[model samples]
Target: MFFNRRTPQSAARPTGRLRLGTAAVAVLGLGVLTACGGGSGCSSEAPDSTTIKDLVVDVLAEPDSLDPFYRNTAEAQRYYRLVYSSLLQWNEDGTLAPDLAAELPEVSKDRLTWTVKLREGVTFHDGSALTAADVVHTIEQAKDPENGAVWLAAMSYVESATAQGDDTVVLKLSEPYAYLDGKLAMLPIISDEDDYKPNATYATTGNGSGPYALASLKRGDALTLERNEDYYGEPMKFETITFKVVPEDASRIARLTNGDSHIVPDLPTDQVELVTKRNANAVTVESNVSRLFAYPSMKADRPTSNTDFRLAIAYAVDRQRIVDQVYSGAGRPNSTYLTYGTLHHDEDLGLAFGAEPDLAKAKEHLAASGVELDRKFNIIAVNDPQVTSAATILQSNLKDLGIESTVESQDVAGFYANLVSGDYDLILFDAPASTSTGFAPDYVNGGLNSQAANNFAKFADAEMDDLLDVALTAQGEEAQAEAWRAVQQRDVETQGNIQLVVSQSSQAWSKQLVGYEPSALLWLNTLRDVT
Candidate 1:
């Protein structure tokens, strides 16, 4: 899924490049032979011949699509950061800065109109000049209903985008959104917006204006990228980056320890020290924007549709035990849907369940559910080590309540497909909200509404929908906070989903890498700054 389909080769060296099928390296254990050797793409050579200036990363899975308008997977979002440039960019400290825009947007006194000036001398990878027209086209396509854009909900407030001249674009908003700049930071500017539809050149391969460009890709195997020498911003320190597909956690950790790769993200908590003990470095970046959550299927035919049954499942599980055992105590147990860093979350909000299990309360809810003991609940999850471990713990917790259940693990693609189809009683996964504005208007308004496309749980409630609308459209901070609190209280009472804990973003890098920093807003985009 990393690239379009390509034929396999033993070891083909292009005119000036050596292609290493890294997906095969997992079985061969050839750690040292994967270096980019004396290639034209290698602008400068490393001091050691075994490793070059190129950054080799071991990733778990390939993204389903490279198009920004279609898929919003974590892997694809990181790829977009490398290949595309946005109107605004977030600084490491979570401040907004100009990227493609000449400066911060100029807002009207009423905060309804936004005026942006495009930067001059910037060019797309396809050699087209970037202008205000591209920006207008991007926003129009994103907000259009016929496009079926994944970001349609986030762009609802944007009424219209019009270009004044060659360099200026103006936006008219339906309401005054305080966080509109943060949303602009997430929108990537694309060239030739006329061809930005599905199955176009921008879908299979990226044509962007960022620091990197796709050189070659072998589907499900390896991806090779070359630095954009004509980039307008600060050039990438590394000349090229090679992403190797290594699905097994142990193999990925071993590759990092043996100096096969420079960076590996999402390391298992127990294996963090293994890389640190060696010459490598391991870091766990804490983030409250993302959380590990369990969402119950709210289909009317399913037993989990009952509020009492859902609450019983929520109260029966011991979140503290799961946090300690599965996560190595790196996170805090949470009972509410929103994390502490989410917009409008406060200490006085709803937390219907305790951190530890309450068996008596669980029994009371179970008796009130009227669910038969013979019905077996099917819990679905991805086939990761920690995810499977958490599923087992939840399985045991349900057994204690005289309930029968089974854990069904699938690969990432299958897991997401099943989740969207609503074929399971429960689904467990991590939700990474990669925006500086937190998870309020986008995830809350889109992921929980009954008729919304991303509402995977099929949860339907008119009051919940109204509360979400208030949370998104409210003008003042106090009004927004009050609406968010009401939404959480309703969420707790309904138990549409169970929030488990806020997990830390963990990764390990080789000591040879320098100037690396952890970022909650920009995950691997920071790699451009690392040498």
Candidate 2:
């Protein structure tokens, strides 16, 4: 059994529907292996026209770096979707789906070993055959600590990734990981070659078995790819795709409005009106990934260190307002830690934020603690547009109760280190979708447990621990999913992350854009421009 932060999904309802599954961590010490995703953040609804295909997405920002290993940034992975292919692909419902590697794994009784056979006839853009060697190299490069691939943390379950034969890859695990197949779906296989460096030019032009090929790329401006003619699976409809880089929020909206580009991402809620009025055609709330959890100062003496205080904050933030004002009401206000479309989502649970607009109630609690309105608190946030906006909203919400707060912004690396090092009173989630499903641990006992150093909020509880312990140790999927759902509900009840808003984005596109999966990842394969 893999020692994962994710607990098994024991209580999954047997009704298999086509809804997007939540990108949730699986039962194991490390949690489910993290996957790749396109840039920016937020969730959305399904497109009105299923017939709409052929895509030329207007990416609001270019990747900081395209080197797959060096640029584990969400923007980088978003670019990779045009070229790379991972072992498995996750379904919208959070089940184990396949992209390159076909089907789920056959696990042993103790559930430590898995045998995965490659789908035949899959070829890279460079005409290289994707075999067990390709899978091996991808895993090896990711596991290298020097590479610093965030997904590698989840791959800790592997003891060896050796080939059983020419086409079959066998992974021996230290522990049972029922969600291993789901994890592999995110690890797009890299082509095995003599001179493989993440910095090489060919790296940007991927050599995988995905639905498309990297046709052209620039360092920070744009990336383009054409459909893989040799691809062994369903053909992409779009002949080519251009990922145009536009950084300024207003500029992205303008491009979509002018029809200069299609499929823009992360349109700020304030600008949705301009986009909708101009294009008269936009997709909002069509895709989503939950941004849940809270980070805290781990020092024993701090108020944030108290589970109740953190819970109180969770209860205070109006998630619906965040979704409505920040996201333009594209998505539901989710209180459970697990995201929508997951086996663990507790549909029965309401918002994590407690009663509405009662400053007296909030002040009463603070006064009971002998805390005065003049007391100061520091909030550290990633220096990004959305983070700034959210921080501003949080400031306004907290100030009504006379809480004195100041917001500090930092670059990406600074943000991660600062939060992990326990330097922030509050931190907003800024990482991309790759870490989405694997971010939340099912219970308190898992290493990826939400209160750990990386958990940002620094919260832990005995109830959370006991519940997770039972879920992980117990057998069967139904029992596990139920326990995981219960954990999400518990977190909401406790005001865990106090998620203010799950951002929803609007992408402008001509009905010509096709093959886009229309999920958070903005999967671009199986797409083509309608002539």
Candidate 3:
């Protein structure tokens, strides 16, 4: 019964087998809790990894901040899920299920209104009962135009959030949004109390109804969490969980082999074989969701603003070469905007830029663009090893086309700053894997559309925006398919952003961890079920 509390297998990929670790735990009993108070965000140094009795997860990137209101990085969301609970959860099969909510919301016939019922008796880490007001407050904070909420664009359709009573919330929308349920899964509920408002102390602290309580934080080094003993749902397997930031791949592998860490996520494909050879009990799993793409700055004066120039950049890069050399053949070259796991993905669309490099066509587009021969370009990317390697290849490809460019490597913070400033000619970015393809609408609208807060590329096209609206408002699957296909077709034609690689996600965990399930989106929300 070591894996007794496993969640149901995703219906989307029922045939996909999960490789489970059979390593026996030396001790099954709960360990003593950490001394820090829950949700205090207390500062402390990390314990010696080799000496810790509980779980220690080795992570590559330290989250920029703990505040979900402003921090939108995948790493931040992973930490947020530990400290807070949302109304719904996205399963690996792309289905939505109730989490804090008593059940799924009842949608109106027009799909403009949603009535949500709260689960009774659920209390936050502060011992306050969760109610409809908390949900309303969270939604309002997210939808506020001036709040600078990370999810503001995702909640654009929401017109109002009002509490019907202690347990019921009514949400009104300006227009029909089929993906409303998925949006609910993104907003973590917090108390309506003013102390927890945006930019308050709550940014560094926690007051959520999740299974784990934030015990202490060492900031960029590590964070320690203790199980919320008063959790209404099934208890977390480990009494304490520590997440240590290990940026180097070698160091993370070293930690895993030496038994200093129980799990190490974001394993590079090239290092998978090395980690498995070092530890027989180490179990690794792969998921198809990490989308690597290029965002060309579409500022009016930038050379990349020219559609022909963008298409030339897209066609010149050898995607298959990047897949083989950079990813160790663990990824596929994608030509269109949508990835394999996404809904309405047309395999036969045959994008303008094929997987293989077409130097002749690239030169033709480059000639048509009439870009100055001596113009230099700037390429921005995170300091990740694979990303830098791919950027180097792109630089080489552009050089062959008589384009001069320099690759600038930056940390996560610097990367985002450069991305939003519209100063760079082109930037390489990754969209973290998601369980729900339903987020496609928000991804298109918020990340790529003109006037969007996060539209770092500055891509503006009236037609694309109209296509996004159709995709978001489409009711039936058939209608949605048509709308999304039109959107993808337009993306291919305009080259607003070039799709690069659909990489597989890899994670290695110790055999001592039982019921350790692999997530398609790498959310790791099932840790509560892992003993």
User: For candidate 2, what is the lDDT?
Assistant: 0.54
Q: What is the total number of backbone clashes in candidate 3?
A: 0
- Full-model lDDT for every candidate: 0.68, 0.54, 0.70
Which rank order by lDDT, best down to worst? Answer: 3, 1, 2
Alpha-carbon RMSD, each predicted model: 11.4, 8.4, 8.7
For model 1, give the 10-residue run with minimal summed lDDT. 12-21
Query: Between candidates 2 and 3, which one is better according to lDDT?
Result: 3
lDDT of 1 at 368: 98
Worst 10 residues of 2 by lDDT: 30-39
Question: What lDDT is reached at residue 61 by model 3?
Answer: 81
Compute each candidate's TM-score over C-alphas. Answer: 0.84, 0.73, 0.86
lDDT head-to-head 1 vs 3, winner: 3
Q: Which pairs of residues clash in candidate 3, taking residues 3 or more apart in a chain or in different chains? A: none
Report the C-alpha lDDT of model 1 over 262-352, residue by residue, as the tens digit: 7887676567667666656665544413466787877777778888998888889887777788777755565666554455554344235
Query: Candidate 2, residue 256: CA error in Å?
Result: 2.7
Model 3 over residues 1-531: C-alpha lDDT tens digits? 111112211213111111111111111111011122210121233222234347888998877677777766667777878888999876544456799889999988888889999889999898988999898888888877667676777788989999988999999999998677777887888788745455455666778889888898887799888889999888777778888999998899988888788777688866756765674133223333566788887777788889999988888988878878887776666666655445566544423466678999899999999988456789887778888889999999999888989998787678676566666788887766453343443466676566566666778899988988888889777787789788878887887777777665567766555445445444666565554
